[model samples]
Target: MQQLTVKEINTLVNGEVVGEYTGTITGLERIDKAGVGELTFIGNLKFSKKWDTSEASVAIVYEGIKIDPGAGKAFIKVKNPDLAMAQVLEVYLPDSPHFETDIHPTAVIDESARVGKGCRIGANTYVGKGVILGEGVTLYPNVSVFDHTSIGDHTTVWSGTVIRERSEIGKHCIFHANVSIGADGFGYRPSEQGLTKIPHIGHVVIGNHVEIGANSCVDRGKFSATVLGDGCKIDNLVQIGHNSVLGRFCIMAGNSGLAGSVTLGDGVVIGGSASIKDHTTIHSGATVGAGSGVMNDVGPGKTVVGYPACDSRDMLKQWVALRKLGKS
Candidate 1:
């Protein structure tokens, strides 16, 4: 673990020292779990009472917050203690893995594939014909890049991931283990010959800084490309159907799904296990709460919750009314 002096930490978080104490912070932990040589933060007022009992040598708190004088712990006061804690955690976390610029012996790259300088293709990975990988790209074990696919510079595709044909992935993107990009959309036509699959002739386009979590699936469009805008984050087991477009900085939590042709505006947040119906539009800054089922468009900055997704306040009112009626 890395260690930083209390003074150095104060500098990192742009914080001011409140008491005279010089100690090294070796780790970051919750207030209840933090020990000596660790740094903890009191982001909520409820946690303030535990400060004196905490074993942490250094504590980050909001400016003007009252502290127990007898605590005897070093204090760093910041404008936003929670944000400061996040920044401090980033400084303490381990660096990402690095690989040599050599393709593994078991890896196969088609003659027509174009791989740029400083790339690392790991064991059993396959690069199909006409694939283009930019400089410093890393494809871990068992990754598959289908024909005509293009991956931009410094992208990392982890093990068991598949990038289907004709997909375009932008720079600095991360596709975690078992992620499937450009997969066939779930479309079918009912006919005499049984339900015939609607062949997905399109691809997937992922913008820069996108990070897709493990086991997520982004289906290819029926005619055009399913688009993921810059800085969009997709959590594990999420499903993005064909022709879905996610705007910049949108966040989809674990197990959330967007049906075909859905559109999400910038900074939209979808909570865990939420489901959006096909062709619905969710405007910028909107939020869908956990387990919600959205069947219509959501306006900008609105927060919706519950099964058929209504405004969060409306949902809460309904729940309260039901509880009162039941008691009566």
Candidate 2:
């Protein structure tokens, strides 16, 4: 464990020290769990009462927030307590282990593949024909990159992840375990022979700083590319259908599914388990709440919720009415 004095932590977070107590903080924990020699944060007013009851030796609090003088803990007041705590965490957390810049013997790389200098290819990984991997790219054990795929610098494809043919991944992206990129789309046509599968000839394009979580799937387009814009974050078990385009900085939570051809503008937030119908558009700054089923276009900056999603306020009123009726 690393220990930092009150003055050292205050300088790190640019916070102002309040109170007379002096001690070194050895660890960071939640308000309810922090004990002696630990630092905790009070970010919400609801948790303010817990400050006095907590046994923590030090606390981080937002500017202008009042703390009981009797709490006995030293306080560091900052503009944003949550962000300050994160800065402190970075100082104490251990860095991830680095892998040697060498390809494992069990890995198979096609003769035509171009691997940049300093790349690390792990055991059982396969780099297919004509693939281009940029500098410092790391492919963990059991990872697969199919023909002609291009992955940019500093990207990491974790164990069991697969990047299919012609997929383009940008720099600093992370594809977690079991992620499937450029998979065939769920397209079919009725014919005399039965349901004929529509071949997906296109691929997936992920922009810089995007992160696709474990078990997530991003399908290839029918003719064009399925795109994830810069800084987008996709949570675990997400499904982005064929030709769907997510704009910059969009966030899709766990279990959220976007149907084929869906379009989301910049900064759109899709809550956990939300489902968007095919061809629908969610404009910039819109938010779709958890478990919502979107069927139509959501205007910019709108908030929608509930099954067959509507305005959030309307949904809340409906819930209130239902509860009153039940009471009667």
Best by TM-score: 1
Residue 154 displacement (Å), model 1 = 1.9
Give the poorly placed runs of model 1, Cα more than 4 Å off.
Answer: 69-72, 98-101
Q: TM-score for model 1?
A: 0.93
| Collision count for each candidate, in order | 0, 0
Question: What lDDT tens digits, residue by residue, belong to model 1 across residues 140-252?
Answer: 98999999999999999999999999999999999999999999999999999999999999999999999999999999999999999999999999999999999999999
Off by over 4 Å in 2: 20-22, 69-72, 98-101
Reference-based TM-score of each model: 0.93, 0.92
Q: If candidate 2 were superposed on the true structure by all CA atoms, what would the RMSD be? A: 2.0
Candidate 2: give the clashing pairs. none
Q: lDDT scores for all predictions?
A: 0.93, 0.93
Q: Which residue pairs come into collision in candidate 1?
A: none
lDDT of 2 at 320: 100
